[model samples]
Target chain A: MPRTVILGVIGSDAHVVGITILEQALEAAGFDVVNLGVQTSQPEFVAGAQDHGADAVLVSSLYGHAEQDTRGFHHRLTQAGLGDVTTYIGGNLAVGQDDFAETRETFREMGFDRVFDAETEPEEAIAALQQDLEIPLTETDAEEPARATL
Target chain B: MTRDKRLPESELQRIASDLRDDWPTAEAVEFTEAVEYHGTLPAEKRFAEVLETADRPLLQPRAGVPRLRDQIELLEGLRTEGGADLLPTTIDSYTRDNEYAKAQEGLEEARETGEDTLNGFPAVNHGVDGCRELIESVGAPVEVRHGTPDARLLAMITFAGGFQSFEGGPISYNIPYTKRRDLAQTIEQWQFVDRLAGLYTEFGVTINREPFGPLTGTLVPPCIAIAVMVVEGLLSATQGVKSLTLGYGQVGTLVQDVAALRALQSLGDEYLPDDVTVTTVFHEWMGGFPPDEARANGVIGLGGATAAIAKPDKVITKSPQEFRGVPTMEANAAGLRTTRQLIDMLLEQDVQIDGIDAEQEFIERSTRALLDTILERGEGDVARGTIRAFETGEFDVPFAPSESAAGQVLPARDDDGRVRILEFGDLALPDEIREIHRTKLDTRAETEGREPSFKMVADDVDAISEGRLIGRPDGSNPAPSGGDD
Candidate 1:
């Protein structure tokens, strides 16, 4: 069975296109994508992951409040029996844009398996997802290799 | 006479009562009395005075902290170092979202850390005296800037607390900052804010009301932004607001950005009420900035030059920390100093570009068509017309998340990096206007060797600071100054 991935723009943010593009790309790469659209809450994300049996929960936060919005998100997922799922986040993840290093570290310590920088190419995240999932490389995603793991 | 949207005397009294009851300290003073004390001040002290002067672009930096003393110090730092002609008190996100409790918490945290945990100052939670203290501490005209959709108490407190200027509008503020808000409701709420300004006007005080421009602050077509401004300006004027300042955000393409500012001021003078004071404000690049501080200064410098050439009444400065997070007071002043230097230097130079008239004319025609349709939709009642226009697809804003916005329009940049509508979507502009955008986009599509897609829009949105105006199909980017042709 194809690996299942759940994606959405987390928090009060409604920047939908970023997640929409990611959803389309994931589907084309043969991953089953359950897109929650924008303004998704932690409970909603957990529910989606549970309903879809998602192996990964990809969160896109462009408005810079994921720190507050996802403070205990990892713990909550663990509470809901999703602690083992791969977690990812990308896009203007902080309020202004300067604290990429700190933001990534904080999120990683918060239990995110991988944290994509705001400027990280969408494909880079995709390759990381494929590699982290230990999925065999499909011919379409073989041209570009994923960078070193975070 | 144009339909007066002013609240009746009884309703106005009731509104005031409820507002004051929310904050008893406000009830201790009179609104007119506050304006009387704050309004006579110079531009350095009274924001409306900034509009009264037209000799040079008044420079302002967005700086806010939770504590009154700290905020006062920050403003002083900006004034002493940045040489800011005007200063801002950007409200925290919690205050903006009407979460007063959260704002209070953030305030406590900020007080504890001596570092603001909140992104901005919480004027609402600080209440009347808090706002008054901040206003009194700063010699420069202090204004409130926030993305609040329902700013009822904020307006009452700030205006009564001695602020002579307020920013935001039903469409511009709501469509861009908020994800889910009813447009008609926000418009009506803003009418109250305007009516508050109107009341100040009745008392011989002129509070400068600026409609937030740069909806989405992305790749918005100038026509769409101008249409929203005209509608809001007309709506505010109908409520007896006499001092209105129009604003436009810089979009990186120098010619197009200058044309956007020029079109805004001209159309304001032409389309808005003759009785109102129509001035222009230029917002330095509201889009994404380079994380590199050096590159960001180049972006801010270009914005300053654009403002000087565009001849706006004032320019809002962006700091070097724009990309990372809330900037330090030092970064804010640094940006203002750089902007002042640029503006002063450009004032002596001609700074005029050839081939600008065509773009200016294009902006004018498009804005005219947008306003004409909106006015026709409401039979000349701007408030009613605005609601009707948004309900229909006639007044669409590109990439707006508001359920009230049609959000059908798609804008992209041409080979010359000027913003143009790739998909007009039911804009109701004349065929000729649509044809112009169609041709420009088609020409760009031919050069890019791909159909007009969202990829172009996404790339164009972040093209600035990457050293170019046009976001090419490929991920390859040029140096910061590579955009200079």
Candidate 2:
């Protein structure tokens, strides 16, 4: 069975293009994607994951308030019995050009499995998902080499 | 199921009173007193007059801060240093989402910390007196620019506070800016806003209503953008808004962008009521900007060049620091100056490109197809038609956040770098129009030796930021400067 992933833009941030593109990339890469669209809250993310039996939750925020928006998100996930679900967060995660390594560490401490910058290509996240989910290389994945760097 | 109809005067008043209660500042929004206040403003402070009477395309920059004093200083700097012809007070996200209490909290925090906690000026939290103070302090006319689905309260305060120009419309603001705001409700709310603008105009004060033209701010096709602008213009016209400025965002391709702007102006005039004065505002590249400031300036320069050729009534400039969330006031002013320098240099030179008329004609035809479908769906009412079209996926925006739109239409650049629809999911474009787009994409596919697919769309979305217009598989064709000739 294909891995089910819950994807959405968190908080009041309305940026949808990145996730819209990412959702297509994930689906093409052979994942059962549950796209939550934008203005998705923590409860919505958890509820979507539970309803879909998602294997992962991919959260995106481009309006630079991701930290504030995601405060206590993991706690909400754990309370909903979704603590074991693999989680990743990406996009312009902060207000300014702060050190990205520091930003990654911050989200890591908050229990995200991986953190991606705004410029991280969709292929990168897809690869990371395959690795974390233990999904071996399939024929299609081999035939079409990941064009992550283009 | 909301029909496009003008709000009754009694309903408008009752709604206005209820909206005023959204915040403590609402108590200060007295209509007649506000009309008298607008009458006191000088001619230059008026948005439509400044735009219409200008000899050249005027430059406006997006700017806003949490504090009123900071916003004044920012506008003043943009005016004096940047030579900005018009100024914008971009509202914070909280205010745009109608979370006035949160905006107020942000405002109070900024006041206490002496730091900008909010992304934009929280006009609602600032109140009528605060809005007036900013308006009085700035030399240029200020427009309230926000992505609000429900802009009733914002309009009530700003209109009374002496702002004569407003940006955003039901479709433009909702599809691009939010996920689930009901389109019909926003349309009804905006009618009240427009009726208020119309009422102000009736009192001899002409308020300019501008529909936010850059839907989704991605690779939006010119036809979709133009159709939305016309619909919003028509809706505003119905509510008695006499001064209308339809907007178009720079699509990175010079010829297509120019053609799109021309279509927007002509079609707006063609469809809107005769009493309404139609103007066009060109937005400097609304998509992703190169993180590098120098390359970013190249993008802005091309937009300036396009504006000069298209001769839009107003140009909204983008700062070099766009990759970052909000730019510093200095950077914002610099963007205005950069656009200003380019416009001044190219405005007088009669540089006309070939194929402009043909491209514009094609855009007009496509726009008419969408408009015709909308009219057909609405059963002659634009509001009803827009809602129905969107409900049925007959009308769509590419990469839209709103559930109201199908968000299925995918746009990719052709070989000549024109935006072409790669995927038309239930869009009401005629078969011939779709064929033209498919043919264009097929040409591009042949050139790339790859079938036209979602991969192309992905690369195209990131092409400009990566320093090119078309996203070739080999990445061999980097633009010599800013991805344009």
Candidate 3:
């Protein structure tokens, strides 16, 4: 089975750092991670996932504009032949001044598979990817052999 | 407790006394002349003396009585020398403008004679093209000026202060004999004559000239200073250039009261070019050492009430503590929130505004957070720990001896186990206790909307060892009633 990817920045209203961090983290996670960095337009994200044949497209935005920026992004992905790809997003996705629950619901309606708040740990992200991939959590052998493929 | 007001005269005397006490051997000159520009004997005599002492060889010839013609000659000579350097450097590399035109000219000549192909891989160009395409794709607001003359003349009026400050400091300081006249001429010729006027002809960037004042002394009048700043800003915007920014020190003292704000507003209204925006700097102390009642009155007593009356596009205000250097996290958080509030308020007033977040304050807070983590946990425990060693205890010292001594002692550990003392002064507490205090603050900030201050996540094992409660569940807890037996 293909490995699942989970990614996003963990902060508020500063997207530039988030984008760069996500790109580096996802590549190191042993999965084909299509990272849609900060202030990314919805269509470009969908295109990136489709082009890379990615199993998942992870979105990270730190700016409070994520609510506006990420609105309808999932639907756009599906329309762009990336419906099979799972979508993940996190960070201070909404302005801190308002109710985050309502904002989360709004994003859910727009088709996000999972939503994490600003404080979600990286380990939690890794666990989520394992669960999403249906990998056995009990596979605790001392070591696993690396698969070689051309 | 409220602090007593320090009178301006007393404050000046105190500063002078302090300087005298610090530098007993050095000769200190005291002048009581009013801060003004041009024509008066005090200013004229000072300007002549400055020119005569200039370090540049060419400027020595025309070092007295800066008439327009004399000013023109001095400027022309500098321009010719500087241009020789500028043209050559531009041809050699795309890095940035050369400080000296002669060096620039040599590089340009070398590039012309050198055999190097400009062609490169198209893919790299494609990537650049892609980035540019992305940037352009993001639609931005278009700014429309009334006309080119309005823009250009307006530029002159704006930048007059920056020009004056850039020119004034060197002369006032009496830097060196050979350089002073040349520097003054360079300021006049390059910034004023060629760049401002020539840009109008070459780029059709119009600039307006209002009646500027005569130089009375070292200090540029507030009105002219502000106008010159505006012109510099306009030129920068038009030329797509950025200048080394200058700080407005003690601007609070200059425009403290409602009367000062009103006067500034009236001057801006009367002289500011139409279609240009104006702003003012106001200093207020929210947290830190309490300002004297008079200085405090000069600040918060106005409560932006005067700002409301002035109705400038923006008003930048900072606490006294921020100016002094060591700003607390709470102060910074408050300041950031206040900036957001101010921006909102200005927007409500239908004004376009941008607030400058004190970079030093932000860096200090962020550094403190990192420092707290390092002092508690040691290196490799947190990401921000790397920058912790850079923080010097001497930074908090107001006087030279204390600062120098702190610098010497702090970088090296004491013969005893303890690190050299922290520079928090009265605020200093036990390092161990401060870490706990900072941890609580960091925890609150993390749980709240703010980002976690530390670069690395707190160690859960260590936290548990330390009796800090974490929410991880163990399977030994009682099963639910509906669980299978």
Best by lDDT: 2
lDDT of 2: 0.90
Candidate 1, residues B1-485: lDDT per residue as tens digits?
A: 22327766677668778766654445555765676676555555767766567588889888777888988999989998889888899888887887777888899988888877888888877877788888888878888999889888888888878888899998888877766788777877787888889988888778889998877877778888888888889888977899888988888788998888888988998987788989888899888787688888889999988887887898999998887768998998999999999899898788789878888898998888888887787787777777787888888887666767766676789888888886666887889888887788778877987666555666776677575678887756666442211
Alpha-carbon runs more than 4 Å astray in model 1? A1-7, A14-17, A20-37, A42-58, A63-89, A92-117, A120-150, B1-4, B21-26, B39-44, B474-477, B480-485
By lDDT, the candidates rank as 2, 1, 3
As for candidate 3, its interface RMSD to one decimal place is: 18.3
lDDT of 3 at B179: 14
Whole-model lDDT values for every prediction: 0.80, 0.90, 0.31
Q: For model 2, state the Cα shift of residue B217 in Å.
A: 1.1
Best by TM-score: 2
Would candidate 1 be rated incorrect, acceptable, medium or high by CAPRI criteria? incorrect
Cα lDDT tens digits, model 2, A1-150, are 789999999997778888888887787787888999999999999999999999999999988999999999999999999889999999989886699999999999999999999889889999999999999878125544232211
Backbone clash total, candidate 2: 1
> In candidate 3, what are the lDDT values of residues B1-485, reduced to their tens digit?
10111123354345435433322221222221111111121322222232223232111010111122222232233224321100000011111111123333343443565522221111111122221232122221001111111121122322221111111221111111111122222222223322433233233222222111111111112222232233333332232222211111122221222233333334443433444333333223222222222232224323344344333322333322342333332333333334334434543464322211222222223334433443343233221221122133311211111111121111001111111121233222345644643454445434433322221112211121122222122222322332111
**Stretches > 4 Å off in candidate 2:** A64-85, A93-114, A132-150, B477-485
* DockQ-best of 1 and 3: 1
Query: How much is the lDDT of residue B468 in candidate 2?
Result: 87
